[model samples]
Target: MSQFLTQLGDAATAVEAFLAECLAEQQANGTPPRLAEALRHAVLAGGKRFRPFLVFESAKLFGVTREAALPAAAALECIHCYSLVHDDLPAMDNDELRRGRPTVWKAYDEWTAILVGDALQAFAFELISEPGRHEDAEVRAGLTHTLAVASGAIGMVGGQMLDLDAGRLPEQPAATIADIMRLQSMKTGCLITAACEMGAILGRATASDKAALKTYGEHLGSAFQISDDLLDAEGTAADVGKATGKDAAAGKATLIGLLGIPEAREHLDRSIDAATAALHAFGTKAEPLIEAARHMGRRGS
Candidate 1:
């Protein structure tokens, strides 16, 4: 367990360093200076780089070296950073802080932040398509495809639409939970799952291995969403990168509002259990992912 935590920590630091370098390169290229600046600001905003760590660690569980997954990990962080920027825009959640710092829109202008989100989204694809020294072109393409599906209209954007229309959803608890899950699957879970599976794919892991990692990802992703809901109920603006308590305040349907905080916590525990079970097939090889599941269960921590 200790060793797995050490490896996960190392993987996270390495991925963050690589992502910063890529952001710097994008800034230095500066052909479209304003767009590049916006993109760089969003990417270098000091994120946790959790999705990137999942990419690297999942690859490791697939028996691939951490070095082999660097490109995919860095690319995933770009996508996540883009999402956070857009999510905080006035037309969206209108948040002011992210990672305990000013949101792009707050620091710059709304227009610049919007463009930055767009540029980062494109840059994420560019990074995914532009393989690192150790990664292959074919693998890069696959990783890009995975990320697009997770972040596009059919994924995160589509989920946002549902969240916007949450008031129209059936008032039943089951219906609300289902709707929340649908919103979360796209808004939160899909990209995380993509990170893990993309790493496995890049590592040349067997289809079976990739599928198992995906299962682990799905459960963990679900827990991540539930944790977000719990955080909104129990956390403050300082603790969460974005705003909290808005879900209930807005009368938006969510797991916490639907099932209550205690029940939501229980649901998160179920998700963790499912995720841990999926990792059991790997024996000790799954320790890093298992710890990740536990981490999601304690998201604010």
Candidate 2:
């Protein structure tokens, strides 16, 4: 467990350094000063960087070096940070804090926050599409295409739209467990799945290997969301680094609200089991991923 945490921390630190370099290069290339600052504020705020870790670990399974995997990992992190920036908008989640600091919109102005998300989203594509990311054009293209779909209307954005609609339509019937699952899958699962898929693409893994990683990502994503919901249900804002109990307060549809804490915990455990099970094809090489799945179950925030 200590080794897994160390590895996770190391990945986070590497990606943070890479992202900082990317931002610096953009600024040097004539990005406006204020915009660059806002970008830094949004992207540099510390988080677990769990998605990037998936990319790194998945690529490592195929003997890909961390250097070879860093671009994709950083690109995925940009998308994630952009999502958080946009999600914190007053028009969205109305969040005032992120990573225990003032959110982008709260720290800056709304327009700046909007531009920060826009810039980060564009930068993510640029990073993935760069020829230097992979020698083969096809690999770069695959990464770009997968990332687009994952972050597009059919995935994260579409899922956010569904969540917003659910919150607005009080007259409609409550969302079923299936509905919640689908929403969560699109909103959160797609990017995570893409992180793993992008890693496979980077490593040029076999089709069966890619499929196994995808299964692991799918189950891991589910477990991640359930853990997040559990945190909201049971944690303090200080511990979580964001508002807590907002889901219930907003009458949002979540497995926790439907199943109660104990049942939701059981579901989370099953998800962790399934996630680790999916990595069976990789043998001991997938230890980090197995630990990652278990870590989801143990998350306190």
Candidate 3:
């Protein structure tokens, strides 16, 4: 357990360093100094950075070294941070707090926050699509394509649209479990799955190995979002680093909202089990990824 924690910590530190380097490069390029500062504040505000850890661990399964995969991992982090900055906008969740601090829009202004998200998202593509990270052009293209789809309308953006509509239609017919799952899968699951699959792409894994990693990512993403729902349903704001109970307060659709807490927890356990089972193909080599899936399910426990 200590070793896993150490590895996760190391991955987080390495990702931060890559992020800093990118920021420094932009600063040197004479991007507006304030925009650069806002970008740093938005991207550097601490979070678990679990997505990049997923990338590195999944790539490790293919014997790919972390340094070789860091650019792709950093790309995913950029997308994730961009989403958060936009999610906190007045047009979105309108939260004043993020990572237990004032949100970007709160610290800066709404326009700056929007531009920060734009910059991070553009930078994400730049990180992956740039030359020299991958020897093969095909690999870089694949990573860029996957990240684009995951961040765009078919994935996170679509999910956000559904969530916004849900908030507006509080009195509308409640969504079924299938509907809720579909929404959550797009909103939160696709990007996560992208992170894991991108690792396979980075390592040039066999089809079977890639499939297994994708399956693990699917289950892990579901479990991760379910845990987030549970946290908002039961955890305090202090513990969660953001508003709690807002899902219910806004009448948004969630597994916990649709099935209730006990059943939701039961579903989360099933998802976690499926995630663990997906790693059976990797035997003992997948311990870190396995632990990561377990960690997702155990959030707020």
Candidate 4:
């Protein structure tokens, strides 16, 4: 577990450097000064960078070099940062703090936050589409397409819409566990699955290998969300680096809300088990991912 955390930290550092370089290039190319600063603030506000680690580790499974995988990892991080920016807006989750600092909206303004998200979203595709991302144009295109589908209306955004709609209609029936699962899958799971899928694409993985990673990602994503819900229910705002208890406060339909903490914890363990099981074909080569799944179940923040 310590080794896995170290590797995760290394991946985060590498991806952060790549992101900083990309932002610098954009700035040199005449991006507005304030906009560039805000972009840096949003993208460089350190987090676990778990999605990029997934990209790097998944690509490594197929012998893809870190150099070849860096662009795609950076691109995926862009989308994630963009999502954070938008989700923190007053019109959305209305979060004031993110990663233990004021959110983009709170630090700047609503208009800047909105534009930062839009720019980051567009920049993600630009990074993925770059010739340097992959030697094969098709691979780059595949990564771009997968990322788009994952972050778009049918994925994260759609999930956010469902989340906002939950309990908004007093006349409507309460959301079931399945409904909550679907919502979380689209909102959180899609991008995570895409991160792994994009790595598979970068490495030109076999269909079977890709499918395996997809299954692993799905289960891992589920465990991640449940852990998040548990954290919100039980963790402190200081420890979580953001507001806690907001999910319950907002009446959001979560697996924890449906199953209660004990059952939800059990479900989280099952999800981690399934995630690691999906990597059986990769043998010891997939130990990092297996550990990652376990870490998701036990994450403190």
Compared with the true structure, what per-residue lDDT tens digits does model 2 show for residues 3-53? 778898999999999999989998999999999999999988889898999
Candidate 3 has a TM-score of 0.93
**Alpha-carbon shift of residue 68 in model 1 (angstroms):** 2.0
lDDT of each: 0.77, 0.91, 0.88, 0.90
TM-score of model 2 (CA atoms): 0.95
Q: What ranges in model 1 sit over 4 Å off?
A: 1-9, 131-135, 167-175, 236-244
Candidate 3: stretches off by over 4 Å: 1-3, 169-171, 236-244
- What ordering of candidates by TM-score runs from best to worst? 2, 4, 3, 1
| Model 1 poorest ten-residue lDDT run | 167-176
Taking every candidate in turn, the Cα RMSD to the unseen true structure, in Å, is 3.8, 2.6, 2.7, 2.7
Model 1's TM-score against the true structure: 0.87
For model 1, the local distance difference test gives: 0.77
Residue pairs with colliding backbones in model 2 are none
